[model samples]
Target: MGSGESTTRKVSFGVDDEDRVRILRGIKLSEDVLQRMRGVANIPPESSSSRQQTILKDELAKMAEREREAAREELVKTMSRERQQARKEAEKAKELAQQLQKKDSQLKALDAFYKEQLAQLEQRVRHSHMFHRPAETCLNVKNQSRNTAPVCPGLQAQILSCYKDNKDQTLNCSDLVKEYMQCINAAKKLFCLLINSEYDLNCISIAVSM
Candidate 1:
């Protein structure tokens, strides 16, 4: 019996040893898996800092792009305003030029009208002088032959003097012009009557001689 008990105790001891071995192996495998997981979770400091820097650079680039877009929009608006102002100024200049051209045309037309009036006045004065000289010569010859006073000589001199004094303003001599015209008509009528009477006298003398 003593031998059998000892043998059983030895067998039981062997079985406990095997179970301990298996539990130790299982713990070791779990520790290895935990170590691998820790290694994967831990990152290098340089790599972390580099990633942060890359993200910061990307943010700064985006900000810069936004700023550039804003500046472009502002420039476009400013250019548009400048174009509009230039167009308005050009229109104003065109209008002013048109007005100046119109005024110039009016001045030229007025100048032409004044020149025409002056030319007509000069022509009338020349014709009056021609008619007056012939009438004066005839009146003088008739007066000498008839043994009579000169006709309207004083009035003729006065009219000529008035015309010379008021050359550019001939209307100032209107009163003198009317009086001189009346004197000339009377002289013409007197000359015609004298010519008719002389012709009758000559005819009577010719009959007597026959």
Candidate 2:
């Protein structure tokens, strides 16, 4: 046939036709196609065979539906498990944050206590006449002592005067002893404060170490 030319063939169902010629001309034909041709030729449907095909199609549809349902259930289970794990992780993070905050509060308290002790020490040293020497003389004497050299008489006199003040106020005859006593007292007070603190020391210690 030419590209633009339409070809028509006459056919009769009962006799051999162009379709039969095509089927006979080395063309493969399926059973379904043959059955459809037979139906077009007025062949009767086989009850048993038709029913069996219908049943097979229904079974396949049902199996497909079951497979889809199973996949959906698996997806739901996976999502639920992930949600639970996420919730647990979030809870853990919240607990860790709370613990960190508590530790920060404890450290602040410790710093405050140290500042109070230092302020008290500074006050005591500043107010004392005997232990109080001019800044320049004190620095010179301290440097001379470090070099193992003799200090000036004026510097020595101021040091001696400060030493007498230290002795008069100290436990025995030394400012070192008085400082020790003050430190001891401060330590005792700090222990009491730690005990009364809201958070326990053990927990704070662990957080700081980590």
Candidate 3:
């Protein structure tokens, strides 16, 4: 009798546990259905019928579409902001490049001007060396090289060409003569300054005059 009673009690306990679980599951499903209805139209759920489910699905679909549209709008706004920022940075970089190019051009121009001045200075030095040679020294040089070759072959060639080209009237070659006289005068001035003043002072004086 006691064994039968114990077996009966165990069977009844298991059945009660199963029933409790089924009741909890039913309550959970009901809450889920209500929550879904409130999420779309905030309408209270009446029953778990197929019609009610269909209405909830339609509203949910509309809500999903609205969410998708809002997300798309947000995405577009984000992309536009990025594009604007990129454009601004590109403009900034372009302006910087232009500034650098302008600076480079200015530097090149100054370099060219400096090179021209240096060339002029070197020419003046060569002319001064030539002109500082006395007329007697030039004559001696000419006599010494007479049997060999021209002392200044290039200069002699130029003068000879000019004279030949204008043999009819010497006046046509007067320009060459004027250039030679100018060199001679410059040589005389440099020589006089060297003999009269200190070297550094003479250079400063020459720069001032120029």
Candidates by TM-score, descending order = 1, 2, 3
How many pairs collide in each candidate, listed in order? 0, 1, 0
Q: What's model 1's overall lDDT? A: 0.57
lDDT string for model 3 (1-99, tens) is 755654332211111442321332212334445446447434555667978899999999999999999999999999999999999999999999999
lDDT by residue for model 2 (118-191), tens: 45644544543422232222232342221112222343344346546653333223344344444534433343
- Root mean square deviation (Cα) for candidate 3: 17.7
TM-score result, candidate 2: 0.35
Q: How far is 137's C-alpha from truth in model 1 (Å)? A: 16
TM-scores for every candidate against the unseen true structure: 0.38, 0.35, 0.34
Model 1 regions more than 4 Å off: 1-48, 121-210
| lDDT-sorted candidate list, best first | 1, 3, 2
lDDT: worst 10-residue window of model 1: 7-16
Model 3 scores worst on lDDT over the 10 consecutive residues at 9-18
Q: Which residues of candidate 2, in runs, are more than 4 Å off?
A: 1-42, 46-60, 121-210
